[model samples]
Target: MPLSSTQPPTSTMELASPMQVLPSELLIEIFVFCTYNDAFFPLTLGSVCKLWRETVEFSPRIWQRISMADEGSIIRSRFLARTWASKSKPLPFDVDINAECADMILPLLAPLLPSISRWRHFTLTGEREEERTLLVSEEPATPCTDLVINFADYDSDDDETEGRATFTRQYPTSDRYTMTVWVHEIPASTILMPLDFTNLTIFECVFTGQHTHPLAVIDFLSVCPQLEAFYFWGWTHEDASLTTAPPTVHLPNLKTMTLKSTCMTRSLLTSIHAPSLTQLYLAHLNVDFQLPPYYSEDGDSEDEANDPSQSPSSDHATGMGLRTFLSRSRPALRVLEMDFSDMRTKDFRFVFSRLDVLEEFLIVASDMSDKVINLLKPYESCDSPVRVRLPNLKKLALYNCQRLSGDAIVEAVSARAEYTDANASSKLQTVSQVEVVDCEGFTSRHGQTLAKTLGNRLRLH
Candidate 1:
């Protein structure tokens, strides 16, 4: 019956099955790559779909790192609790409390005290007195592993002379893995507070005043057995009224140190020792304090000759403390940076020898004095077949050096190459590259001249 009526089959297209979906592991990886804002990532991802929300809820690692804006304390607490309830893995959390909103914000975080054990990275800035007091008392629900408290704003108020004292007395002691404190523009009384935490690895104290005592800081560091880095920035006054001297404290585990002072003397530099230090930074130092081996019978005569304006008791010296510190720790140091352009040329020569193992040397000299240039010049010529042994050097940076000419700088670097080759016994290795950055007085032509002089040895950035 259909022979005459047989028609071509309808042109219907076949439908393909849904594309194979990615494994949950792959999705989680994608989430991890996208994971950033502690507060926003979880909330935003939760809103995408039921499946994604479930995946995020179950991924504790994703929720472990939380950074809530001071404005979103309420949301942070609620989200945090829910994440915990979902059986997500426990991870480190970073909570940044806003300094301006600290008063209003402290109350919100108080309720989360029970869950504090979940915190691994706790950052508190501009914290209110009551809030800090409360946090110091709350038993960690989860042991905090890393804590960073910045009290730079303690001196932000005109009437807050007691801010440092309050912070020192009330600073929270955590059983965390590492702790760092940065205190600026505070008085000595604040600096005198004892740091009792034994587990701390990194500690920094920066004070700006005419009377900052380095001794107080040194004493505080001596108590910590696990300390790995210590930094001090002290500003002293010309008047001798401030009697507190920097303490001579030694931390055997310390690997990095930075010290800057407007009035530090040579003796202060020689007293401190940290045998394991790998990086050192010094700035705004005085070089005249490095006293000569001999002086006239009349001490007053020598004092007057050095500087009539400076009192006999005034401590001044170039690289005195640095030289002392390096003499003990230079063997381990890999990075060395000095901003001593404000210092005299005599200090550079005194300090250069200490940086024999330094792989990265950054110098911001006040001027390229002839002494400094000569000291920096390679002891040999470019034609010499011997290679310089800056054995570990990968990068060398010179900044804000106005007195050195491009040609002079190149010659000095070439000499370094020569010195390395000449001294077969020396491990001094030739630097793979030299970088000159942010030198206002240096022109592009100067850079070109350096490139030409050093040949392939120089890299200008």
Candidate 2:
């Protein structure tokens, strides 16, 4: 009879490989490393053989991530659901589901609903209100710490879209009640959610409609006192209505803010008190630098203040609003970015002078005239006590600054590096990195000089 093919070779020349004889624990560890690149990856290795399948099936970490969507049929979804149920429970569950794939996911996920407290992150997007309601219904007791909601409302009658989003989380009475909402709109709509906001830290709202009541945004923020970051983006025509000055909402922990609007930014900035703010980004395309009357002592009417025919050079009003905001908040701001094509030289100086602790400053597609460069350059007064602007500045980036000259750029960098106090201590720290992108006047010669001062820290393109 022929020797059994499955049997290990008896001779010393041939023997069973060490891999085949590896312990179950070691094999499972090797499997985990093999599947680390993708989520729900062990499922691929589990199909090789009976022993390997059992090994993968028993590993909980290998099945911690459940990333599934419809595969064109209910039969496939049902099989996938069964597979998830049979595998180990992935703590801090992460899930992403949309309206189209909800039907297949809901039933499969029904069995895991009792353990909703394990969920840490989730994203839900839907096309209809009913779909959103159903999705929330299955997630009544989620302990999710981070969430994202995107909804699209499309009607057959018209080409435009109107959407409504609603998210409700039912926690199992825990102390950690903080949850963040990241909101955006592609098709226009309103977002509605019911949750405790005392512990919330971040709010990112993007408006796409002609108007979203400023009160609506304020109402949501008013309840979240612990909010740390906020972002708003909309177009010029989508003007927000603030009939009167809104109540000042204090966000003690807020550290970052990005606002993109025409006339609404004035009211929004004035109505918030963020003492911890360190980063501020502003983008406005409107010609008139009209701020809310609440900020102006003269109390000008909105129409007069918002006149578009006014020259963009009249940016003092806008600059004053920002300066007042900084003075009130008194935040140790480290980063300041702006997209101001016509920002006044004096206004820029006033703003820069206040940020004594600024570390990173970026000017994008803005005026970089000799006057602006002089304001940024560090200098000691000959008649009075010594002083420096942006003493802590380390990273200076100027993008598309057409008016900046190579000599001026070199002078600015060298001044910071050479600044010293009467006691010989460095008063103003030198910039370790300077990035000049598309600044036509800053030629290779300018870069060569900067490289000598900043060495490899100079990045020019």
**Tens digit of per-residue lDDT, candidate 2, span 142-180:** 433332222222333124322322234434444222322
Task: Output the worst ten-in-a-row residue range by lDDT, candidate 1.
Answer: 294-303
Error of 1 at 85 (Å): 27
The count of backbone overlaps in candidate 1 is 27
lDDT for model 2, please: 0.57
Query: TM-score for each prediction?
Result: 0.50, 0.56
Give candidate 1 misplaced runs (Cα > 4 Å).
1-128, 132-211, 239-247, 265-268, 284-318, 328-331, 340-343, 380-392, 418-426, 438-446, 453-457
- Give the per-residue lDDT of model 1 (tens digit) for 1-461: 45344565445344432322668887777776676544457678878878888888788666654443345445555455445434444454444444444323323333333345454445454543312322322343442223233334444543553343212212256432332333442223221222333233222323423233434434445544445655555453442122333446666677776666545444445555777778877676534443333221211222222322221232324334455566755547788777762434444555564556668888775554545656655444477653333445656788766655556666666666555545534465665678777666457887776665456767666
